[model samples]
Target: MKKLSVFFALLFLAFVSLPAHAGEIPIGIYGTLTGTDTDVNGMSYGPKDYLTYVNERAGGVMGHKYVPILLDGKNSIPEEVKVFKRLVEVEKVVLVNGWSTGGTKALRDQINTLIKIPFQAQSLSSDVLDPQKYPFIFLLGPTYEDQVLIALNYAKQKGAKTFAFIHADIEYGRAPVRNALEQKIPEKLGLKVLADIEYAGGSPDLTPQLLRVKELNPDYVYIQDSAGNTVKILRDAAKVGVPAGKFFGNNYNFQHIIPGTLGKDAEGFKALQINADWGENIPMMKEIEEFGRKQKIEKKDAYYTKGWVQGKVIHELISRVLKKTGGKIPEIGQFRIMLKDEWVKLENFDTGGGTPALFYKDHQGHTQARIVEVKAGKFATISDWIKTR
Candidate 1:
């Protein structure tokens, strides 16, 4: 009788010790964590770390923590599709963050129609912003087209007459450059484009291209490439004596890691970025700093902060649902429904001041970017927020 009573008591205690929520809110994120274009580590890590901080510090979103299953796409589109399936069908995740232009564009139809899971991605392709076509896929920032417009507008203001365009021979590299050269500049902005050049990513020598750029001497050079490839371009341009001040970069190339890699060669380099720099003491960044210290993270950058903002948006939606339902976390379907019906209407949504206020009705979320210049081994915001759309 005493053994039976003790067993009952222990069972009751175990039941009480279990967490109040049924299970974690599973979210999926896939990015190019490794491979040649591995700058996404900071981008992917930021959101993961913010979710970790939420669970550890804020008691999670309504006491149900975000359980993220992250995978590395290795910058491959096919691999990314497989990872997406694994996250959705196999893992049954309700929300996801994707990477790469090819992967995001490839999965847009399925994610919107068949899967019906809410997705936000790192790719800034303008095609994905159509609400009628891709209702489930949200872009984390302005589109590549918008970035191009903003960069060109800035160039025009700075007395740039003609432009030299350089990009990798890939979809991501081609998309914005194509839009700018073929449509935006000639028709809309009335700017002159001198030379359009395509090079393979991570090319060892860009002397031929830099030599061409030097000959043209366009008022500015707009480069659409990753950090690794950007290093090659800038170094080769310096060697070829292309004026450093005449060079500008897209958002992916505006990373802090680039300046560190280029040292003195990176001086006067300008690039467009979607968010504030690392050391900016925004409200959310203060919290992130504390979280970083606890986790032994010595540095944080713009990409990391961008990821953190993505996680924050997901958390905010879940939080609203939980609040409305009296601490009851909604099911996956309900969560999707809530986002589609109500959550997206959120106006002036705070993305930690990393980017502009996100107004989701237009489906592009604050089509604004800041220009940053590398000065004294760090990136500094040189211009006020400029709307691109």
Candidate 2:
């Protein structure tokens, strides 16, 4: 959407008609795609659907075909950084979107902050929302901390007293550990955390952690790791007889850490909170879903839904300002100002009808969340909705 930039500029300039631009405009989409495994990185097909839908019918935003340049970070940070720089400087792209939290963080840190280009993390994390840290980075979902806190409370209400924290001993693992522990008992709900143990991110065997957990026998288990190690933990958890308590897992990082290894064993495991499908009910979801179906594509994971939402929402904001700017972006600074203006107006806005939102202003502007669990080889919601975000 370079055309979107032109469109926003037009809006600022009080010109209604779209201005013509030469050649195809490049929009950066940085995420993992074309992998056998799904859900970790957004499906490339989903973007294809979104682009195709808008292009085929809407004629794309402001007459540009929405050419998304793929920079498959492949869940690698360095690669993500390299691609991000290439997208902004070499390619002269107006915006960037992609997969991988590590990649998002890498771009945020590596890029020149003063450049002030808007960035959104398709991954479901609030780390990027810190106004102090990555001011330009926008999150599209509730913080995992809020999600777990809601879960902790829910567990307490469901007679959960002791929680076992089984997480990969890494940054993602540590953040949740802090959130789960910092809270006091909420009124009548008796929630107590028993053990907070760390498992290797890719550990082949999780016997040590499982055995340690079994000795304590917690009332609930909250896992904060992904990849093959997560599967090993699930399998070994079953093998070691760690009491049939409520189990919470991370978003199946698509490494089959859960579905591949845990197989049916992960059924009913209440891990993270999210919506079921993007298209079955919601308008935005419908837009992407129908687009995918028409284009002969399928986007299984809600993460991709969130990513596409990021694109649409960001574009919507850009369109808002660009309408005023006479379809031309004066500089990166002005673009940042336009985003800040749009965000301030939507400070209280919530996408309540569908999908859990990325929110947090203090910690993050979290919108809402619903807890989902795996049932019979597919994910199912445990509660109708949990609005912790």
Candidate 3:
């Protein structure tokens, strides 16, 4: 009897020590944690860290803990598809925050027909903006087309007529330029498209491309590539006498590393600014800073801010669902459908100055961005917030 009593006591202690939450809510976060585009890995780490903060600080959102599953897509489509299957089939995540324009485009059909979970993509591709067609997918900012138009409009305002495009030879780099041209946006902005050039990402030298750009002598050159490639483009532009001041970049290229890498060569480089930079005075940064004290912040830049904002959105939606369900998590299928319905209703959502107040009626939260130029080794806002709606 004494031995049995001791065994029962141990079992009771173990059971009582279990987490207070009824269950775990798995959320998938996948990005280029490795491979060529690792410069953007902050997009993946931001949400993971924020959700971790939520688990520790808030005790898992009304008795259900958030479990963020991180995966590396290696910036490859097949690899991303594999990661998607594992996140949906094996882990059974209710929501996903994904990365890369190419990967998002590849998974759109599957996300709509098979998985049916809410996907918050980092890609601002206009192709996925149609809520009627791609109801389950969402973006946090303006489309790539919008970014191009904003740059073109800025160029036109600066008294520039002809412009050229230099992009990486990838789906992400090619799509924005293609979309802009097909839509005739440059012509509408009173700007002519002179040359569209493609170069392999991380090329050793872009002197040839810059020479071609110089010969064309377009008043402005818009760059569509990652930060590393942007640095290369700037250095090679200087080498080939293509004035660096005449170049502009998309959001991905507006990175601190550019000026840090190229020094004076990166000065006067400009790109679209979507999320506020790290350490900016904002309400959200307080929470992130507090969390950082306890944990290491993997990426400390605008992309991380973008991810933190995404985490905020996820927390809001999940809280709403829990409230509606009376704190009881519905079955996975019902929970996913509820999430999708709740997302479209999100309006004027506060991001703590991460971006303009986000509205998800069109499945794209913020459609406004400002242009920032590299000055004295940092990106400084050069224009007021431009609305792309």
Candidate 4:
């Protein structure tokens, strides 16, 4: 009888000590954590590192600790849709973040049609801003069109009289390709676009295409490639002495290619990244660099940058959400609206400076990119601060 009584008391104590909301205040975060899939950018670490940043200081979102729900989209269109639906129906998480371009587009209609929960996407495509189309989706960066325009403007300043374009055949590559092919952008910028080319996935050698471009001698080359093949393309171009002096690419490659395998040949490569590598010579970089050192996150690894940016955005969103609804479980719809509405404060727009804004309504952030140059051996920044875009 005494033993039974003790067990009952222990059981009651356990019940009382349990967290009030063990399973509540659920927020879903999914990305390409581990897999052959690479198009998502370094988004694989964005949420995890951001959450680590949050938990390191403050307890959790709204004092209710969060449990990150990780899912591997496998960089597939259909698989992403399936996983997203499972995240909604099976898990019933309140909010979500981190779906790449293909995955984000896949969920566009389904999210609008059935699930009303607001989803935060790491991708910065223009398509997400259409409220009627993707009512529940919010993009994390500027539109693809704006990023391309920024690259275009840079090409003009570099005196690119004509352009040669190449891209890995994928939905992610389609935007920049179409933007280059369809638009009279070069004419407006007082330049000419000479050659536009497409190659099959995993083409192994871009030599034929690079050879053709060399023959054409376009002053600039515009390209987007799968993450795996980006290094090879740059290597091939360097060997052939392609006439692409001013090479421009969208965000897909900037975070993925540089500071690594692309090697010394990729030094002069210039890309318009939505986010700059505050990885060097910046206050945030300094702070995170110290933290990274402690965490053994190599400065060369782009995850540190992606994590830092994700932390910044998450910090802003949490602050805004708290101010609006302190302790209560916020209305999911209203919370989604707030998530989309809040913007992170950025130091310089783009790579260096002179741009005044960080974000605007048309699915774009004004952040400039570091004008990285390949000097001596590897990628070096000719101008740490590029003011144009």
Candidate 5:
């Protein structure tokens, strides 16, 4: 009777030890879902929604369902770190999709040294581009430095002799501008730097800063900020006699909501287009649109396009790993290493017209972008895709 009782106890322990959903891949995703930076919440939802589409339509990859565990980082560095620990130590996610430049920078060393899970960052900050130091980190597009260079080149081509920068006072807003100035990128492009203006993000009024900009009256002003702040800058610039046509913004400022919100005030505003806009006649949009029909798309803009492309990349990499491991998911640690190894091997990979063919040899998936201007209150591609190497 004692031997039988011990055998039953062991069976119960084994049953409880099994995963709640066997063969489900847990990928951790955290972003500013409900916070000051909620304007870009689609960045978080894009991957989750794409993975859901895979689960519902195709039953996941290689019979292993992708279980995306999304959490709100609140765009705070401490919150992001807490979420990262939960995902890595408790949830045991194979990969993490992180948000914010500050959070990505804050967690870089920990991600490399201790956690060792693959990370996909939404930040395009050049500071985090060193693969030797942060081997597990990857970005969706060109570095912010690249975007600055592209914008400077565009300004020079349009015969602008002097430029200034108006950026929010944050890591995401200030780093790229500092890098550009330190590198003498504007000088190399034959444009003189007139002013480097920094302001608190989400400030209700930027007229004082715009008044300073009006005094300098730089030929062009490069805006480094989120959608909300960009709108504030534009409205104040117009009031301060700065033409909206003279302001250029990076990819983050390229959102339909901006033009839709400001209307004519947003006219003539230029931004970098790293991903094909939503509803474009591209191959990938067909899938996104089909998914939208079944469910309400949170944000119908380029950011969503970027998220969908990220999902596709994750799907392809996981599929490759599964095929190599004989259709079986390996142990968590080994699986993450394999994912990182497979990620770097991707080259000239098609993203269904989301961006130019992506090459991840340098850990930035794509480096090409085009200039889009707000014409008639809509973003229209103005130049051929410019390579930002």
Candidate 6:
């Protein structure tokens, strides 16, 4: 009887040593689901839908389903901070996917130092790429500065000398423009800055700003704003006699639905294409389409693809770790270490045609951009995937 008791005690000890939450992986998502600057709603939805599909079809990563605690900050910094803290402390999520430049920056130190959870931000802010300062923060693609640099390079190739930089008076809009106008354009590309314009985001009228841009007669105009304001800017620019063909925008401006939404106003609008176009005959696109068909989701935009790609990365890393551990989820530190050590080694990661290739050695997944121009009511690839300095 004593020997039997000893054997049962050993078995209980082994069972207790196993992970408490073995069958469920808890992750967190923070984005602006309902806000004025909520153009990326579809983007957030893409990942959510993909993860749902994974849970439904493939039984999730290594037979463990993801329990995503999603929160909306409504594009407010204070609100984002509150939500982020709750996600880390209360929810006890091991990983989080965040959005908004302001919120990401605000939570950088806490998430990196205190919480120590691996985080991927949708913000392409250059500050987020500094692995030394933000060891926990990972970006999906090229920094916003790189996007601006690509724009400058394309404009230079097309013989555009003087340029007008227009962006919202927000951190997301200001950071890249500052990098371009104050540093990269002059130091590297040797381009002339004609005007630095700013306008209220989602403003009904940008005629005053476009008039100022027209006064300078800039050879090219670089805009950093959301899709809605982008259309407004283009329309007002046309009315103010700033040719739409001379305009260029950032990655956020290049949604697949813009042309159909803006009709002729979106003509000649060129922006950096970080991912493959939606209708492109790519394997990822086909997969997304089939997934959408089954889910009855009709609007799969660029933002959606972006979100899906982010989810894919998370799924890949977790699946890899689980496979290596014989279906055991690693501890939080182990998970973070594996992501930093093993996942960053991924070469030319398949981002479902959303990006060319993703390798996060220094935490910047993409370093190139493809320029796409609005022609005949649709985005047309105008240049190859050009490398950024």
- Per-model clash counts, in order, read 0, 41, 0, 11, 0, 1
* Residue 221 of model 2, lDDT score: 80
lDDT of 2 at 309: 54
Candidate 1: residue 40 lDDT (0-100) = 46
Q: Tell me the tens digit of each residue's lDDT in model 1 across 1-389.
A: 99999999999999887556646888888888778678645777777777888889977776577798888888888999999999988887878888888788899888888878888878888867788888887876778888777878888888777887898887888887886666656446667888888887767898898999999888888888878888888899889888567888888887877789888888988988887667787887887888977895523677888888888887776777777777776777777767664546767888767777777776666788888999998888898887765
Give the alpha carbon lDDT tens digit for every residue of 13-125 in model 5.
Answer: 99877544448899999999877778877788889889989988888987778999999999888999999999999989999989989999999988888878889999999
lDDT scores of the candidates, listed in order: 0.80, 0.60, 0.90, 0.60, 0.89, 0.79
What TM-scores do the predictions have? 0.91, 0.78, 0.94, 0.78, 0.93, 0.90
lDDT per residue for candidate 6 within 1-389, as digits (tens), equals 99999999999999887554468877788888887667766666666777777887787776688887778888888998998888878887778888888889888888778767788898998967787888878887778888877777777888877777899888888877886656656447667887789888767898999889888898888888778788788888878777778888888888866677778877898988777656667777777776877786534577777887888888887877777788887776777666656556766787767787788788878887888899999888888888774
TM-score of model number 3: 0.94
Q: Pick the candidate with the highest TM-score.
A: 3
In model 4, the Cα lDDT at residue 335 comes to 60
Best candidate (score: lDDT) = 3
Candidate 4, residue 260: how far the Cα is off, in Å: 4.1
Prediction 4 TM-score vs. true? 0.78
Candidate 5 positional error at 289, Å: 2.1
How much lDDT does candidate 2 score? Answer: 0.60
Candidate 5's C-alpha runs over 4 A off are: 1-22
Candidate 4 lDDT by residue in tens digits, 220-258: 777665446656567778889852245766556655345
Pairs that clash in candidate 5: none
User: How many clashes (backbone atoms < 3 Å, residues ≥3 apart in a chain or on different chains) does model 2 have?
Assistant: 41
- Candidate 2 lDDT by residue in tens digits, 50-77: 6556667877666555676766665556
- Model 4 CA deviation exceeding 4 Å by range: 1-24, 34-41, 131-135, 243-246, 255-262, 276-283, 286-300, 331-363, 383-389
